[model samples]
Target: MPVQFIKDPNQVGDAINESNTKPVVIHYWNPLMGEESPFLSLFHDADENLGPNVSLYVVDSGFINPPHDPQELPLTALYVDGKEKQSVPFNVDQVRDLIFSAV
Candidate 1:
C-alpha cells in the first residue's frame, strides 16, 4: 500500500487503530533533518517494496513526539493489532526487515 503521511501528532492513535486491521510501519522523521533525509527515501522505497500486506505511515518527528520516547531522529516502529511490537533506529536493511517481519 501507499505510504500514509501522519499530518498531526493527534493522529497517532488513528494509525494505531488502523493497525488492528493490518500491521502498521511507522517511520518517524525529523523535518529539521532536511528534505533530503535518507530515511525518508528509505521509507519511500519500503512503501514500494512492501506491497499491500502492510500499512506504512510517516510521522514528522520535528513536529511531534512518537510513542516510547525514542531517542533516535529517524525511528522505525512496527505495530500490530493496535500495539507496538518493535522500534529500531533507522537503517535501510533493518527497516526492510522490520516491515517484512511484521507480515
Candidate 2:
C-alpha cells in the first residue's frame, strides 16, 4: 500500500474504521518539518516494506480538519482490528520492530 494522506484527522472515524480489516499505522507529522522531515521518507520506506496485512496513514497536523490533538504531532499509533494496540516511540528500528511484533 502507498502512504495514505489523512487530510482531516478530526474526522478520522472512516480511517480508523478501515483499520478493522487490517492493521493501520498512523504517523502524525508536523508540516513545519517540511520535506526534510525524516518520518516522511521513513513512512515511504515502511509503506513499501510492510506487507498486505498492514496499511500506513500519514496525517499532516497542518492539514488536520479539526478536533484532533496537535500535541500528538510526531507520534505514531499502531492499531489492529480497529483498536490502537500501541503508541510507538520515535525511532526507525523501534517502529519497524513494533509493527512486525504486532502483526
Candidate 3:
C-alpha cells in the first residue's frame, strides 16, 4: 500500500497496530525541518520501493511527543506483527533493508 500520513497524534498507536501480517514502517519527522531536509529525501526514497504488504506511515513529530529526543528530527521505526522491532535515524539504505528484510 501507499504511504499514509498520520493526521491525529492520538491515532499514532492505531497506525502502528493497523496490520499484523506485514512489516509496518512509521516515519516521524519534524515539519520545522521544511522541505529541504535530507531526512525527507530518505523517507521518500523508501516509499518509492515499498512493498505492497508493508504498511507505511508518516507522522509529523512536532504534533506528537515522540519517544526519542525531538532533536532527532527524523526517526524511522520498523514494526513486525503489531510491535515495534527497531527505530533509527533516517537512513535510506537502513530503512530499505529494514522493510525488505522483514518481508
How do all models score by TM-score? 0.83, 0.75, 0.75
lDDT per residue (tens digit) for residues 1-103 in model 1:
7877876878878888888998998888777777644766666777788788888888875543444564576788888888888987867888878978877
Estimate every model's Cα lDDT from 0 to 1: 0.77, 0.68, 0.69
Compared with the true structure, model 1 gives a TM-score of 0.83
- The candidate 3 region of ten consecutive residues with least summed lDDT is 35-44
Which runs of model 1 end up more than 4 angstroms from their true locations? 61-67
Clashing pairs for model 2 are none
Query: What total of clashing residue pairs does each candidate reach?
Result: 1, 0, 0
User: What's the distance in Å from true for residue 80, model 2?
Assistant: 1.3
Instruction: Record all residue pairs in model 3 with backbone atoms less than 3 Å apart, i.e. clashing.
Output: none
Task: Give the poorly placed runs of model 2, Cα more than 4 Å off.
Answer: 62-68
